[model samples]
Target chain A: AQSVAQPEDQVNVAEGNPLTVKCTYSVSGNPYLFWYVQYPNRGLQFLLKYITGDNLVKGSYGFEAEFNKSQTSFHLKKPSALVSDSALYFCAGGTHTDKLIFGTGTRLQVFP
Target chain B: AAGVIQSPRHLIKEKRETATLKCYPIPRHDTVYWYQQGPGQDPQFLISFYEKMQSDKGSIPDRFSAQQFSDYHSELNMSSLELGDSALYFCASSLVQGANTIYFGEGSWLTVV
Candidate 1:
């Protein structure tokens, strides 16, 4: 079985400031990690994924995440935030047999 | 690029009524997945199909049944609908069962009164 965890229910940040949304996962075999963002009344949109290779992965909308193997964490980050970035973000990933499991989600509030 | 398409973007049904949601996966994609998302909650995996066959099951209720067609389209049938059945139903598709990216549809909102 595989699972994901996003400890924070909400993360607030001011525009132009750096922000981070943490995520952790547990998988039986190798992991495939992903981050998705959902706007109001919309389905999830793919942002980024980590299959292997580099520890740092960049995604759309100037977003990036680090895959920390030792820590078993994949935290989404942004250098400069924008108010338009406010939305619900989900962390999902797992093994081939287990399919994908989504985290509870974190509501990002970027204030302008 | 062509994306997954879903029908009946919004549906309203009475208690004990049945509802059917349709999904059209991206062209050439062979796998489809269904998920249910309640208000302010995360999306829960329901079921998935590969090559017109059931591949895996999750927390899907016995009242709900889904199948994939020859054209790679799928439908989810929900019976004995209750108020708790109200949620945003999402359909996702990928090239294979464990593809790296699974594109999702806009979702069908079901309101069971």
Candidate 2:
């Protein structure tokens, strides 16, 4: 079984300020991690994924995540946050496309 | 690019009633997945199919059943609807479900009352 944990229930960031949502994974072997964003009453939107290769993975809507194996973390980041970027962000884990185990989710609130 | 399509984006059903949700996967995609998202919660995997065959299962309830047609479209039949069944149902697809970027539909909002 694979699972991801979101340490924060909510993160507050002002518009134009940088933001981060923390995530950690528990997997037996090589881990495939993904980040998704969901607006109110909407489906999960793919932001980015880390399968293999570079530790820094870029995603949609100016979002990026750094995979730290030793730390067992994949933290979503943005150099500058926008009000529109506010949403519920999720961190998911899988080995190779198996059913992904998702974290509880972290709500990102960007105030203008 | 054609993405995963789901029918009846919003549905309202009474308790004990039955509802069916449809999903049209992206063209040439061989795998389809169903997920349920509760309010303010993460999406939970229900089931998945590959080449019209059941490939994986998750926390799907016995009252719900799903199948993929020969054309690769899929249907999810949920019976005996309960208040707990009210949630956003998402249908997602990928080429073959392995390390592929799985794309999700806008989602079907099912309201049980």
Candidate 3:
């Protein structure tokens, strides 16, 4: 079974400050981790993925995530948060069944 | 880069009525996946197809069926709609054996009345 967990239901950060949305996962085989963002009434947009190799992966919108195998975590990070970054974030782990199991989601709010 | 396309951005249906959603995958992509996201909920995988064949399924109701066509387009048919079925249906496509970074469409909003 493959499952993802976003411990925080919501995260608040000041614009220009750093932001981190935590994610952890459990999978039987090699984990294919991914981060997606969804805005109001919009479909999910892919941020980045950690299939293999590098632990630190950079994504669109100046966002990145670090895949920690030992910790079973893939936390999304941004050095300088923007108000436009406010949205719903989801972490997912791809399964052997060729489907992705997603976490509940974390709502990020970048305060100006 | 061409992205996945989904038809009927918004749909409304009554109970027991049937609804059909269509999806067109990106060019050269051989895999298509369907997911349902309820209000205030994470997206749930419903089904997937590879090369016009069913590859995997998850949590899809019996009343709901989907198929991928020869051209790699797909359709999801839902019968006996219920209020609980109201959600956003998303279609994603990816190249088989490639990076496997599934790209999602804008999604179709289904509201069962």
Q: How many Å off is the CA of B92 in candidate 3? A: 0.7
Ranking by TM-score: 3, 1, 2
TM-scores, chain A, per candidate? 0.96, 0.97, 0.97
Interface DockQ of candidate 2: 0.74
DockQ winner: 3
Candidate 2 C-alpha lDDT tens digits along A1-112: 6789999999999999999999999987888889989888788889999989999999888889999999999999999999999899999887765767889999999999
Q: Give the lDDT of residue A62 in candidate 1.
A: 99
Q: Sorted by lDDT, highest first, which candidate order results?
A: 3, 1, 2
Question: Where is the poorest 10-residue window by lDDT in model 3 chain A?
Answer: A92-101
Give the CAPRI rating of model 3.
medium
Alpha carbon lDDT at A66, candidate 3: 100
Worst 10 residues of 2 chain B by lDDT: B94-103
True interface contacts reproduced, per candidate: 0.59, 0.65, 0.86
Q: List per-prediction Cα lDDT, in the order shown.
A: 0.93, 0.92, 0.94
Provide chain B's TM-score, model 1: 0.97
Chain B TM-score of all predictions, in order?
0.97, 0.97, 0.98
DockQ of 1: 0.70
Error of 3 at B19 (Å): 0.3
lDDT of 2 by residue, B3-96 (tens): 8999989999999999999999999989999999998788899999989999899999999999999999999999999999999999999875
Taking all chains together, the TM-score of candidate 2 against the true structure is 0.96
Query: CA shift at B34, candidate 3, in angstroms?
Result: 0.6
